[model samples]
Target: MSTAGQEEPDLRSIYHASGPWTGQTLYVAAHLGLADLLDDDPRGIGDIAKATASDEDALYRFCRALTALGMLAEHPGRSFTLRQAGRALRRDAADGFRDGVLLQSGAVFRAWADVLHTVRTGRPAFDHALGMDYFEFLAANPEEARVFNRAMGATMPAAIAALEHYAFGTCATVVDVGGGDGRLLASVLSRHPGMHGVLQDLPGTVSQAGENLSGVADRCTLVGESFFDAVATGGDVYILSRVLHDWDDDNAGRILRRVREAMPAHGRLILVESVLRPADGDLRSVLGDLLMLVVLGGRERTESEWAELLESAGFTMRQVWDDPGLATTRGHSVIEAVARAEADRPDTAHSSPPKAA
Candidate 1:
C-alpha cells in the first residue's frame, strides 16, 4: 500500500512539540492586549509596541511569530492584522477566551509546571508551588482573584444553555451554592422571571456579586457563607456549578450532605459539571480532571461515579442533560438529582466532620 513518490512522514519532528511555546506566546499577546489593539485595523509593530510599552524589535518579532501561527496576517510592511483566531483573543468579543487565557497562562501555568509533584504525592501542585492552597492564594492576591472570577464568569453561557434545556419545574426559589459573583444565578433569575434566587459564596465574592446582581437585587439574596457550614434552606432547587470539582470525594460529599440536610424532601440538586465519559477519549474533560488534580486535589467524575456520589449524599439521580455543542469547550452537563425519600436516606453517622477554612 505504498504511495508513489511519497516519502515516510518524519516522526522525529513530532518530538519537537511547540504547544507550550505557542501557548506562552498567545498568553503574552493576550496579557498585552495585542489582539484587542488589532481588532479594528492593522498596525505596524512600532505603534503596537508604543501602545503596549514593549521594545519595538521584540514586539515586531512577536508579531511575526503570531503571523506565522496564523493568528495575525502580515502586511507588505511590518504591520499585522488580526486573523479569525486572533479575533477570539479580543477582550470585547462576546465569545472571547481572553480572561481564560490570562488565568491559565498565569498562576495555573506556573502550578502546572510542577504537576509531577502532584502525581507523585497525590496532592495539589498549587500548594507545593505557592506554599498555600489555591483559594487561600487567591484571597491573599485580590487582583489574581478578580481575573479568576472573570474566567469563571466567561463560562457561564454554557451553564446557561444547559439550564435552558432542563425544566426548573415548580422551583420557586433557586439557590446557587458556591456561585461566584452570581453570574450563573443571575442568568437563571433573568431567564425565569417568577423565580427568586440565592447566590452563596465567600464574603468577598458575595460582596462583588452584589454589584453584578444588582438588577435582580429585589428578588435575589446574597449569602456570604461557606457551603461546608450551611446553605440557605428552603430553596426548591439547589445548584452546584463547577463547585464539587474543587474538592476530593470526602469534602465533596460533605458539601453535598450539607445541601441535603438543608434541602426539603421534595427539593432537587443540579450539578453543573463536565461528566467524564467511560471510554476516556474526551480530551477536554480529561484535561479538566488533571487540572483539578493539580490545582485542587479533585477530579471529574463519570456518570456512574456521579450517581454513586449522589446516592451517598441522600439524593437519587433523576436525569443527566448535556449540551453536546459545548462539550468541546466547556464540557458542561446538568446532572439532576432529587432528595431520597425519608425512609431511604443514607446514614451519616460515620461521615467526616466539616473542616474550617
Candidate 2:
C-alpha cells in the first residue's frame, strides 16, 4: 500500500526505456507489410508469411511482437486480425498513410540512422547519408522522390481548411513561394475567385505543377526560379507553405526577405506549417517535430519561434490559426504574417493599397 513512497521512483525511467520498443515494433510491422496483408483477411502466421514472402518463423516472431504491442489479436486458432490501432495500415483506404509510413520506415530510416552525425556536424542526416541534400537526392531518385513528395503534399487538406478559415478578405494576387506542384496554392486560388496566383518554385518542381494546376491555370502564373535567386514580384499575399521547415533559420530568413522585397509594405505572408506544441493531447505534432530532426535536420518550431523568424525577416505575425480536428499525421497551423505597408506604419507616408486584378 505504501509502494509510492518505497522508491518514489522508476516511472520516468520505465517510460523512457519503453520508447524504442514502441517505435521499433511499429516499424517491424510496417516493413513486413503485415497489416496490409491482414487487411484482406485474418491470416495465420504461416499464411501471412506466404503472402508477404517472409520466413515463417520470423513472421511468427513479428506477429507475436505486434500482438504483444496490442496491434493484433491472436486467438487459440492461431489466426490474427488487426487491433483497432493497427487497422489504419490497410492499403485501400483513400487517406491511408501506409505508403507514407512505409516510405519513412524504409528510406528515411536510413537517413535517421545518421542523427548522431548530424548532431555532431550540424548538417542534415539526409545530406550526410546520401552525400547530397534532400531535393538533390529527390532529383536523382525518381521513384523515392515521388513517395517523399506525396508524403509532403498529403498534409494539404488540413492546411487548406486552416487557410480557408483564416480571413483573407483583402488579398487579391497571392504568390505561393516555393509551392511545389501547386496543390496548396490551387486550393487557395480556387477559394477566392477575385484572387489570381503566382506559383513560384524550382523549374523542375514548377514543371510538375502543370497537371495539378490545370483547373486553376487561368488564374495562376507559374514562375520557375530558385527562391534565393529570383522571386516574382507584386502580390498582396505571399505564401510559404511547408517551405520554411526544410531549411535552417538563416535560409528561411533569406526566403522571407526575398518575399518582403517583392511585396509592398502592406503585403501579407501566409506561413503554413505544423506548429510544434508541448505534449498536450497532440502527439502528432510531437512526432512530426522528431521526424524533422531525424530526416531534415530541421526542427518543428513553436509559435514564438516562428514569430522570431518572421520578425528577423522584416515581417510581423498578425494572426495564427489551426484546425487540429482536421489535421493529418502532421497537425496544421496557418500563421499569417504581414509586411507592413508605409500607410499602415507610424513613420512613412501612407500609400494606397496595391492594384487588384
Candidate 3:
C-alpha cells in the first residue's frame, strides 16, 4: 500500500531526538541576550559575540543553527536577523516569552531529563535531582527564584484575562492566597478601584511582591506567610490563581480549608486554573499537566475532580466560567465556589494534611 517516492515517517527523529537540541538552543539564545541584541537590526556573528563576550567561533555555529531552526534569518556576509519567533525572545516585547524560555530550558530542562524516574516512582523528578522540593529549592536559590518569578509574571496577562470573565462588583476585600509577586492582586485592585486586596505568600516572595504591587500599594496589604497556616480574614473574595496546580490534592485541600476558615459565611472562593479538557488535544494544558507531574508531583484536574476537591474542603462549586476566548492560549479557566454551611466544614480535628513538600 506504500506510494512510490514517498518516504515513511521517522518516528525517532520526530518524537525523540529534536526536543533537547531545540530547548537548549533557545536557552542559549535567551541566556546570551542574542535576540535583544538583534532586536534593532541584523548583526554579524563577530559583533554579536563581542557584545555578549562569547567565543566567536562557537557563537557563529549557534547563529547558524538558529538560522536553520527558522528563529534567525541568515544573510550575505554572515549577518543575521531575528525571525518572528526570535522576536518573542526580546525582553521588552509585550508578548515576549523570554523569561519563560529561560525558565523552561534552564531548571525545568534539568528536571525533565529525569522524567523516567518520575514515571517509575510516582515522585517529582525535581525533588530527586535537586534534593529538595520545588518551593524549597526556589527559597534557597535566589537567582533561580527570580527567574521563576519572572517566568510566572510572563504569563500573568493570560491569567489576568480571567478577571474579565467574572464579576467583582460584590467584592470589597479580596484575598489572594499564595499570590506570587502580587501581579494578580495588583491587577484586581487596579480594575476595582473601590476594592482592597490582601496578598499572602512566603516571606521572600512578599518582599519582591512589594515592588510589583507598588502601583496599588496603598490599597493592598501584604501578608508574609504560607496559606496552609492562615490567611487574612474578612475578605469578601479569596483568589487562588495558578496555585493549586502546584500541589497534590491533600495539600491543595488544606490550602482551600485555610481560605475557607478565613472567609466569612457568604464569601466566595475563586480558582483560576487550567481545567483539563475532555479530549487530549489542548497542547498547553497537556504540557502543563506533565510539567506539574515532573516538577511538583501535582496535576491539572478535570471539572469533576475540581468539584470533588472543593467539596472535600468545605466548599460548593457554584459556577465554572470556561471562556475559551479568554486565556485559552494559556489554557486557563475560572471556577467560582462558595463556603458550604458551617456544619459541612471538614473535621480538621480528626485528620491532618501534610504541608506541601
Q: In candidate 3, which residue pairs clash?
A: none
State the displacement of the C-alpha of residue 218, model 1, in Å, after optimal TM-score superposition.
Answer: 1.7
lDDT of 3 by residue, 211-250 (tens): 7788899998989998888888989889999999998899
How many residue pairs in model 3 have overlapping backbones? 0
lDDT value for candidate 2? 0.75
lDDT of 2 at 213: 85
Q: Model 2, residue 67: what's the lDDT? A: 86
Off by over 4 Å in 2: 1-21, 75-77, 277-287, 323-330, 340-357
* Model 1 C-alpha lDDT per residue in residues 46-102, reported as the tens digit of each score: 888999999999889888888888889988668988999888798887888888888
Q: lDDT of each prediction vs. the true structure?
A: 0.83, 0.75, 0.83
Ranking by lDDT: 1, 3, 2
> Which 10-residue span in candidate 1 carries the lowest summed lDDT?
348-357
Query: Over 4 Å off in model 1, which ranges?
Result: 1-18, 278-280, 326-329, 342-357
Please give the range of 10 consecutive residues that has the lowest summed lDDT in model 3: 348-357
